[model samples]
Target: MDANQQVPSEAALLGLLQQFTLETERYVEAISNRHHLHRTDLNALAAMVAAAREGKTMTPGALRAALNLSSPATTALVDRLDRAGHLERRRSEKDRRQVHLEMTDSARATGSELFSPLAGAIAPVIDALSPEELHIVMTFMQGVIEATMTARKDAALAEPMRPLPGT
Candidate 1:
């Protein structure tokens, strides 16, 4: 513990963080229900929207890897999204065989409408933090998220594949 931090305080912080995660998951499930999307589809759309925000191209292969879907499944997803006017495919100039995916304007607008309210609601709380505190929070959150992602990856590699219950 730091000189200023007590053991009980640390434990309380951990408990609060865990609680926050559970609440956030519930919120995401609500959003998924509102849109009538399967959670996996929502996850894929989230990843695609994030890529769009960063001006990154998500190729079919990359999407497959990201979603852990088969080639045919990925193609089906791309086609479904295209039909919904949510995503579009582009061919590489250098290689006609290469296809990259990008979100349509409608998709971006819909995603923004759905997700921006949380950001708006949290702005005041985030703004209340001192600059240094905000920086530390951001840095710590990034590390924690990355650590969890790595742990999940490790578990996937080490464990036998299992289907969902009642599947």
Candidate 2:
């Protein structure tokens, strides 16, 4: 910031973060609707893709835990994606009993189709950032994510929701 500029207030910063989250959620919902995928399915695919980018294998159990889903629900999700040609189940060569999931070409194409426009829109802003600015932004994002995860864990341990009087 320049000498004449004031730092953003915490409320203003949080508001901006909220707006960014809302817009991102809207974008993801639009993609899910257009692709005829449930949000969970899209989330599952995203988890798998992130794992692949990290050079880690995604197994059914791992996915279930990542998504906090029941085994049967995860199995059903895998089957649905498999039938849609979006993913493949491969037996681990080192352990035939273990199964790993791989995103198929179709899934990659769909993901590109879904996100390319958003990436194009955001690329210029990201490109304009200096390395130092980029590092700060990355660190800020990581901090935000960690805080969000901590909040989620806290919420999970809070009192469970109960039905309203009428419902």
Candidate 3:
């Protein structure tokens, strides 16, 4: 093996990882669309529902940060979900200016019903994994997530496009 040569193991692993991600995304998108929700809205709804389930509330600012959206965009998303009766925003009692988001009862039920089977479907595969294999898979997944996050941050920081000064 030459010092300059890359490891075949790494290349094979990366290819499988990429394929898994692409297929998973397509599957989620199909599920979301079938349920009459955009992928982003479904993601937001799931986040709000999970937070509520944990007895925690999320503010618009937090939601915006999590979803990587501007305040206005967050507000619009909240407005749409609220209008659809999927979520509700209430002014914080301590700080009336701050708005907290929560999923409606119907939304909670719907989300649970939709996700339960999906969880069940993956349970068998999870059960089949040995503890050590599960740990390795999770560690590799975390590395991939970190790498993707870093790439996104780096892209965000790239120099802005500008027309030639002479033109």
Q: Pick by TM-score: which candidate is best?
A: 2
Query: Per-residue CA lDDT of candidate 3, range 1-167, in tens?
Result: 99999778977987988898898888788777778877778879877766767888888888888788988988888888888798878899999998888788978877777778778988999999999999998998899899999998998899978989997
Q: Where is model 1 more than 4 Å wrong at Cα?
A: 1-11, 53-55, 161-167
Model 3 misplacement above 4 A: 1-8, 49-56, 160-167
35: Cα error in model 1, Å: 2.0
Better of 1 and 3 by TM-score: 1
TM-score of each candidate?
0.82, 0.89, 0.78
Cα lDDT listed for each candidate: 0.84, 0.96, 0.84
lDDT tens digits by residue: candidate 2, 1-167: 99999788999999999999999999999989998998998999999999999999999999998899999999999999999999999999999999999999999999899999999999999999999999999999999999999999999799989989998
The sequence of per-residue lDDT tens digits that candidate 1 reaches over residues 43-162 is: 678888677678878898988898999999988888878887888888998899999888889877877877788789899999999999999999999988898899989988896878
**Candidate 3: which pairs clash?**
none
Instruction: Point out where model 2 deviates above 4 Å.
Output: 1-7, 161-167
